[model samples]
Target: MMAFANFLFIVFLLPSLEALSNVNPSEYQQELNTQALILQACSNVENLSSCLSNFQGELQKSGPPTAQSIIHAALRATLDEASRAIDTITKFNSLSISYREQVAIEDCKELLDFSVSELAWSLMEMNRIRAGIKNVHYEGNLKAWLSAALSNPDTCLEGFEGTDRHLENFISGSIKQVTQLIGNVLGLYTQLHSLPFKPTRHDHNATTTKSSSDKFPEWMTEGDQGLLKGSSLGMHVDAIVALDGSGHYRTITEAINEAPSYSTRRYIIYVKTGVYRENIDMKRKKSYIMLVGDGIGKTVVTGNRNFMQGWTTFRTATVAVSGKGFIARDMTFRNTAGPLNHQAVALRVDSDQSAFYRCSMEGYQDTLYAHSLRQFYRECEIHGTIDYIFGNGAAVFQECKIYTRVPLPLQKVTITAQGRKSPHQSTGFSIQNSYIFASQPTYLGRPWKQYSRTVFMNTYMSALVQPRGWLEWYGNFALGTLWYGEYRNRGPGALLSGRVKWPGYHIIKDARTAKFFTVAQFIDGMSWLPSTGIKFTVGLGN
Candidate 1:
């Protein structure tokens, strides 16, 4: 019995001794690796030593840390700075200020509010990974939100063009530091494979359906299926807008106001055959709202607001959707504020998981302001001129027709002005399997932001496309940073011989290399598009 007790002592004590013996070699080496990787991430960041300090406490607390954890800490740091900026903006607004100062401050407040939302979104995505809800698209989504958050301060500074430099100085320094931190985090995220911890991915089954027996996807109810099938019988029409006294609401706004907030199921609003001239809006609370129409041209929602008419570009949408999971089918959204009335927007959609099928957006400039979030457009007609398809949304357009109208002779006809401000952002124009028909001489797009990205794949471009293919936004700006690519495109203007020779422009050599911009890889559309009943190809198809 004495020998057995002594043996147990030796057995337990050895591990402790062994742990102490190798602690310096193994653990210290791991910490060194962690520090090295994080330091590499802090490359190009201002005040590198201060930025490294933010990770010190987080790194010391745990075993080895991951890029994910580092990103979470980075976001926390960014949010704190942004919150302080908000407080400063609010305090400044209450003080005595001129009209220019007031307007600029108000605009800055609104933009900072959006930046806060973007940070919140980034945090949510990070937390989702922690909650074990693994998603391949989480990286893409986080990049988009963080990039937008970083760009907000820059965008706010743009709004203060004529205002005093003092006001811009107030928010610029603090927010600029915050954006630098965000950029550092994004740079770290690119090394996720090198960092520890792989997300245990699970199948995202929320937007996919398996229905062999029905004519529609399983997520669709009997009523919605019937309505989309060209009959109103058995249709669960939540609201209807008609010109005569034959519907639930006379105007589209009335029907939108009636939509219940936070609805899990769809609230179908059927608009009858009429040109209902109204600027429609759907707020954030009104999720899962479906707008069905009699037909594309038959049911029109038109507005004539423009920047020239004293309205901001954001406020000029004929139909602005801010809800999540919004769907619009068989409709035409138009802004009659023609080409001369610059910056007129026909449809402004900033909704997540929004889908537009078989619709038409008609305007000369800013035809479709796909402002943000994940969006899908299939079989739609978008007519515009001069930086029309603009915004920083992670958007995809499949089998659509994009027509360029005549712009002011001096006003260059550029189809897209994608505002992706960061290299890591997943936001860009992925025009795949589409047609670009030009009524005037046009360029494919110009870099709207430093790291702007736009890809045209498996599409046809008309001959009127300018020989240079892409025009520069400004002299020597974004020429090396922007990413513009073309793959397997056909037609008179698809030739690569005359395309921009910028370092960022690529004539993709093969399908495998170009697959990164496909529907499946870019936005993870396969997880959602099946439910929308939209025809989309996952990759370069025969």
Candidate 2:
């Protein structure tokens, strides 16, 4: 923990270091090292002077604080700042001049609300770590939640892109401070979390399955794995949704609303074939909910809310999921707002340990929003024109079909806009053994944040992907920092001769190295995915 001895030193602590001659040399050096770590943690903050002043002479001359204390203090400070940010956003929510700005402020309020929750969760997790209950699960959850909290500010600000800047300018400083504090705490967490990732082949003692094999997770049963194999009509369902009066509910939203909250067992909702024209928002409180539809195109959930219609990109989803263990199969989510609507999303998922199979997301821009946590998609059809498949979640798309539609004339198109802000955060988009069918030429992805990461492995790409496989967000922006890699991709667009020369782009010729981006290692799906009833390739085995 005292490894940051050579890191940045605070100006106020120089006098104590200068007086080291009169004290025990090793003891005084250790104190200075601790002070140096604190300074280094706050050094990269956007508002450095303000963050340094936040300590308020807390560095006493008596003794050095322990590493655990430093981590807890940082978490507490971040939580406090996030609470204040929520207040500032709420005040602005009451003062927007125009209707569109008010709507944008509403979206801001929702985003800040989530940020506050995540910050509080971070504090609780830090308390657990302080109590000597640290592990890889605790560390992973903290990283994901903190990273998601850090991204809300940018998304909140983006809602006012074409509107007046009054509300934007008013909340910018407060939100930026929250992001800075989040980044600082992330840095400190990376230094403090000492555990390594559990091994890929490590067998977890799963008590849920009866076979005695270490296959499925303790949360999933053996019968669950056999559900997706064939028709589940004989399977017991908690609710039935049909357009006709034969079923229990007429609308899909009604059935979803009736779902049990925080359900430990899978609460299945079988939806009959019909076009559901509803905007459904599945909140985080509803966990372990599974939605089964008749089939893609037969079971459609369509909406027209879009950014051009005064709805923020964060709120334009036809269907949004924010719960844990959300599973959806044989469904189609569609946004009929057309290409001119700018940022309409069909399916937005903020869910954890979520899986989608045999589904389709149709739109012009931002069709599928993998917003946070661990997600997996298999054999799905995703269609869009712009940066459609985007977000900060650690997601894996296996055996899926990605179709790039024609964009508006003179508008350049990109496939993804991954929003990863911190390097330590285990969040990225991995397309494995899939196909990219493009109707027009497009770039692979542009970095939405400085630390964005995405990779395409063993995927087939059409010629419309263009010779320049990757695009830059802007000149000299995240071009040098974002990581973009392609491994063993086959097709005319996968040629490396014409790829852009960026420091972050890689051809990835090594075999073992490519395994790091697989479903098993990237999203840690080996544990939870075995009993999902969806077929997935765990690793890139020879």
| Top-scoring candidate (TM-score) | 2
Per-model TM against the reference: 0.84, 0.88
Give the 10-residue window scoring lowest on summed lDDT in candidate 1. 204-213
TM-score of candidate 2 to 2 decimals: 0.88
Per-residue lDDT over 331-413 for candidate 1, one digit per residue giving the tens place of the 0 to 100 score: 99999999888989999877777899889999999899887778988889999998889988888898899998888768989
Error of 2 at 236 (Å): 2.0
User: Which ranges of candidate 2 are over 4 A from the true structure?
Assistant: 1-23, 44-64, 195-226
Clashing pairs in 2: none
